[model samples]
Target: MGRGPETAQLSKYFYEGNDISDLPVNLSVVWNGNFIIDNPQNIQAHLYKCSALRESCGLCLKADPRFECGWCVSEKRCSLRQHCPSHESSWMHTSSGNSRCADPKIIKVG
Candidate 1:
């Protein structure tokens, strides 16, 4: 589906809850595509969630809009630019200033 102006070309296919500070575990589902869940119990569960997807990128947010997409962090700085499917796979890095990411790296477009 085509993304609207309010939304970007990419979309987050997975998520987890921030109610609890811990991660999740014992997840059962297809080992492909991103998965969003809540009330995690451990890191292993998150690892599974990460591994389940073919190209899982972006930061795991606790909410939407304020933390919309995969690049939302409420600290001293924040970036609206969605993270690449793979952290290391990305060549760009968002700096603390504007809402967009800087330092663009050329990737081989398939």
Candidate 2:
């Protein structure tokens, strides 16, 4: 049996042409063309990242937005504002004003 008229376009979206990255990962049944990832945990697990573990100033500053972490330019460490260098000026996140990391290298994208 074929998909009814209501779901035909959605079926075409998945089967005919769809970016694999755009597929819903949380759903147990994800479809893109003939390939499918059921219960996508492997890729989901990769999503969790600790901001403190980021090695470089740029890496820490450019980290995932979900986790709140800042780069201490002087200390050369990545941590939350409370844990960074014990000085508010040294800690630099995207929103911090008067941050020590005013150099051209530490550009924060809007």
Candidate 3:
């Protein structure tokens, strides 16, 4: 990730748990690198985003069955939950009090 004065500032802001409501109107552009100030939420989200290939199964601690072993037998399989082994402990409640796996962007759909 790119690091510099701007990155440091964004990191500090996010670490403080400041509300994003105070962010400027051009939050999308700013976060997209169209401007100097990077949106802290976007940066942190990307940093912690889970990778199916790298993450393992939280329950089994083995290769992620959804992507590798394909042995998940639950009616509501892990894939449906977008499970990320790295965030398993907090899968039910993330920093925002919501499961990141539930995010539409992360969930796989047929």
Candidate 4:
């Protein structure tokens, strides 16, 4: 039997050389047998999402565009009163307040 139009299109994009080895065997049936390849950005995003540091600190060392933490340069944990050159602020101070540093439940990413 011949492939349907949609299937043919998908095959053209993902299996141009008739190589199915790149496709995941478990997910071959997810999108009507379409092979889903993760682009560079998608793979990076997934990595960031699964990262322990990213989850704990809400900061992706590889993906976040903004400066979320100031521990990149410091050799030790800084107190709220200490100045951080990377953050340009006191280590324990966030934009909101000093409670972020005081929170006992906060997980250390490093």
Please give the CA lDDT of all the candidate structures: 0.33, 0.55, 0.32, 0.32
> What tens-digit string does per-residue lDDT give for candidate 3 at 1-110?
97555442343322222222123223343533555665667542221112233233332223323223221223213332345344434333222233233312335567
- Candidate 4: residue 50 Cα off by (Å): 10
lDDT of 4 by residue, 40-94 (tens): 4433211111122332222322323333333222423422223444544434324
The candidate that achieves the highest lDDT relative to the unseen native structure:
2
Spell out the clash pairs found in candidate 3.
none
Supply the global lDDT for candidate 2: 0.55
What lDDT score goes with residue 70 in model 3?
Answer: 20
Worst 10 residues of 4 by lDDT: 43-52
Candidate 3 error regions (>4 Å):
1-33, 39-43, 46-77, 82-110
Report the lDDT of model 2 for residue 22: 21
How does each model score on TM-score? 0.19, 0.41, 0.18, 0.19
Tens-place lDDT per residue, model 2, 22-104, is 23234334345455656545544222333434767666777665566678766777777777666566778866664445444
Q: Give the higher-lDDT candidate: 2 or 4.
A: 2
lDDT of candidate 1? 0.33
Top-scoring candidate (TM-score):
2
lDDT of 1 by residue, 2-76 (tens): 853542243344446423323344543322244454435533343123112212122333223332333323221
Winner on lDDT between 1 and 3 is: 1
User: Sort by TM-score, best first: what order?
Assistant: 2, 1, 4, 3
